[model samples]
Target: MKAIVVVGASLAGLRGAEALRQQGFDGTLTMIGAEPHLPYDRPPLSKEVLRGTWEPEQASLVRGDNIDKLELDLRLGRRATSLDTGRRRVELDDGSAVSYDGLLIATGATPRRLPGTDGMEGVHTLRTLDDCLAIRAGLERGPRVAVVGAGFIGAEVAATCRQRGLDVTMIEMLPVPLEPAVGADVGEALAAVHRDEGVDLRLGVGVDAIEGDGRVEAVRLSDGSRVEADLVVVGVGVAPETGWLEGSGVKVDDGVACDARCATSVPGVVAAGDVASWHNRTFDETMRVEHWSNAAEQARAATSTLLAGDGGGDPFESVPFFWSDQYDLKIQSAGRLAGADASRIVSGSLETRRFLKLYGRGGRLVGALAVNEPRRLMVMRRQIRALPDFDEAVAAASDDGSA
Candidate 1:
């Protein structure tokens, strides 16, 4: 039987394997992962898992029985050190090689660790299950938590700490949470939510250093203020986990460059999830999204293209979609708005903390961000697929207009 090898036991990897099986490929499947744990849902790690609402083990997406039934050669705790595209083989860190008829590069990313704080006892990041366990344990002890980034991860961590009754403070170099992703207006709305929840939200403040001898005791800011905390969770962001493929001939820009079908430059090699960067249809540009839905959608598209056999479509086309639950609000965004030349407020009053913002470039609808209104996002999706005029839609979104 032909062997199809998937690297990185992340969301995309697991979903891709399932899609391949669903496509009726009865080949030998091997999954390689650096972490020893089974594939788990990461979006919950920073949210429910840290809040004590979910167990750490409950975060896993795939179970042992499922893998056994699939008859997948599960290689847990094995890291792919390098890839030999010419030979169609993957080199494992254990000095072993796995030959493959087809390969999928779903090796996700690692949290960018803070420098000089690696060996420190109390510094943490919430990328993997182990990291969540460590942070959850620290929260159980009611340690003061200082989060170094105000992005989604940082905000969720702060909210989780507050839910556990631990003193929490969030620090960000920007003036608001998710300023770059959603723009200043929407970001400030999120910051207000954090403040109303009793979080010490610090904006435009840089971390001078993490202060402590052997353990974290305080976080010093660039403005000379210090927040005392026994625990620190750094959510600065993540870089693509492409170190293993450094000399592997797979093109890596911001991430592994893939065509619309998620195929890499090397034949028979594909990439998906946060590790893969491809042309975004709505934005008409290349992007690498780290959201959970993106991983699943990309994997499904990649799998279909793979099974179709030879000279498939140019690329996968899916508008970006991601959601976050914090302080009773369900925030959702569809399509990419970074290149928006203009935007207008739509539906619900912005001052009331419930609204949808429409973005467009050259008068064409590009994206929409909604706060506490998920139904509107669903409508935005259909309108986005048609590439409607942003000006009319922005005016109509408030009038209960159809997508």
Candidate 2:
């Protein structure tokens, strides 16, 4: 029987093991997670978990019976210190090692820490369940909250702060929230939401330094402004957790380099989830995405390759899909709209915050972003996957039935 080792007990790692089992591979499954808890959904850490809407115990991704049925070897609360590709073993920080026949590197990224605040008391990040637990405890202390970096995580944290009726200030280096992911226009839409919710949305400025006598007391801005707050949540972003594999012979550029099948450069080793960057078939480019759907989709492909060498049918080029729940809106989008030639107002209106924006490149449907209209995006995803003729469909969809 083959022994499969999966590092990083994340959403992808858990799902990858399940996929291996589903593929009828009765192998020795060892899952290594740095965090002590079992695999749990992370997207909720910023929204529901932080807002006191979902308890930490309830945020678990894998339920009871799934692990026992799969017969997985769970290694919780232990960090894999390094990888030895030659010996096919993973070294743990506690001076132990686990050898494997097949390896899947799913160790997800960690929240980028603010320099000089590592051991600080109230500085927080929302990544693991322990981070959520610590931050939630601080939230109970009723400390004024300051969130750095206005990406999706920061925005969600600010929304949660408002939900909890805590005094919150969101600091961003960009002029608008979510500038890098969504364009300026879409980012402005999100910034407007925060403003309407009475959040202190400070844009175009970053933290000069976090200052306090002992614990976090205030955030000093680059613009020479000081905002007094008892707590600071740094949501700047996440960096891929690939440092442990430095000498493992696994190719690591921006992330673990892989082909369409999620195969690492090293034989007998595979990578998936946010840490894996491979040639994207749909866009015909090399890219790495740190999204929930991408992780789940890639894990299935990676596991299939490990078990039966199926390599997931074809090079995955489907438009990526991601959704975030903030307040009353469900924002959904498919495809890479970052570098589109032009975006046409498709089915919805941005003014009302309930519309869809279709992006085109060389006269083809490249991407679509919908706010509160998930069905439209679902149809748009099908069109993008099929690579349909944009002109004819736009003309035909005049009557709602075809689109």
Candidate 3:
């Protein structure tokens, strides 16, 4: 390939570009990004950056000198408006077209917003650096913060707000936060941690609307209750940013549909990160992971597939892993936990807020969740790669001396 074009200019995009260079692809590499700033770490936007523990620059993914070494034809503040698969060209919002011998789509995702909340002051979504700064600025007012969605982002934001001595109210439509991912038992234990730290967690309730004359004054719940707040952070979830690929003939089911090797429907094109919904040979399932780890790992896999000519590369069968920090707790999980049918607490106890739980599906170990027990979690993570029998894995966990 003579030239390669990478969209997104995000963590995945940056990683993909680096992989292309490391894999000996000394081609004309063009990276087009909608944001003006270079790629930076996003995981800190909700924790270190929002909590004022780390400055914005501290979250940068690469140094200026190192990025210069990549020799990227970096086009910042330029959005890819559309793709033409036939001509292998990408049309930018600036009305310019860039043709490529290979393409990597790592556009990632956009956080979902509440209805009628757009243009409203004090209503924010934590996705970009500017979004984090805006929310941080609002935090200085010591406002009563209402965090919608009890997911990782919402939980982290609430925890950070409470640490700053601010009144925080977190609302979730489900009865327990993260129930779908880690099961109800584990999710409730996590919920207890938030309550212990004085977070007003309103579960099994949906946001009716954001009530205010102009600025966000309160959030009305579906159960006829109101959480009065000066600021609101919507973290309901995110949708993959695939609108630009609508008529490109590249399949998009939840994200850019790809094979196990990260090869998309269109030849010479591949996708990674939150924007790619690919088959995982490990779990024999199709998934799109939005976690920080998956973004970096999948980018390299996607790049390998792009260089290997579609089906020539090895399958990207990775065991997904993610971590989140909330208050005094450090939560980590590996493998697929969404469709788990059985789960068992293998180490520690939920009452103590420290444990390693194993999730199983179809009598095989499929996932693991750890709260404070990093060592045991990694052991389970390795065991999960072989898809051990559920009961035997549980039995092994009991005999493991390291755990």
The best candidate by TM-score is: 3
| TM-score of model 2 vs. true structure | 0.95
Best by lDDT: 3
By summed lDDT, the worst window of 10 consecutive residues in model 1 runs over 305-314
Per-residue lDDT of model 3, residues 217-331, tens digit only = 9999999999999999999899999999999999999999999999999999999999999999999899999889899999999999899985688799989999999998999
lDDT of all predictions, in order shown?
A: 0.86, 0.83, 0.93
Cα-based RMSD of the predictions, in order? 1.7, 2.0, 1.2
Each candidate's TM vs. the true structure?
Answer: 0.96, 0.95, 0.98
What digit string (tens of lDDT, one per residue) describes model 1 on residues 22-115? 8788988999999998889998888888787888778878676776666789899999999998898999999999999888889888899888
Residues 323-393 of candidate 2 have per-residue lDDT tens digits of 88777778888987778776665665667888787776777777778899888788888778765665655
Q: Total clashes, candidate 1?
A: 3
- Pull out the clashing pairs in model 3: none
Q: How well does candidate 3 match the true structure, expressed as C-alpha RMSD?
A: 1.2
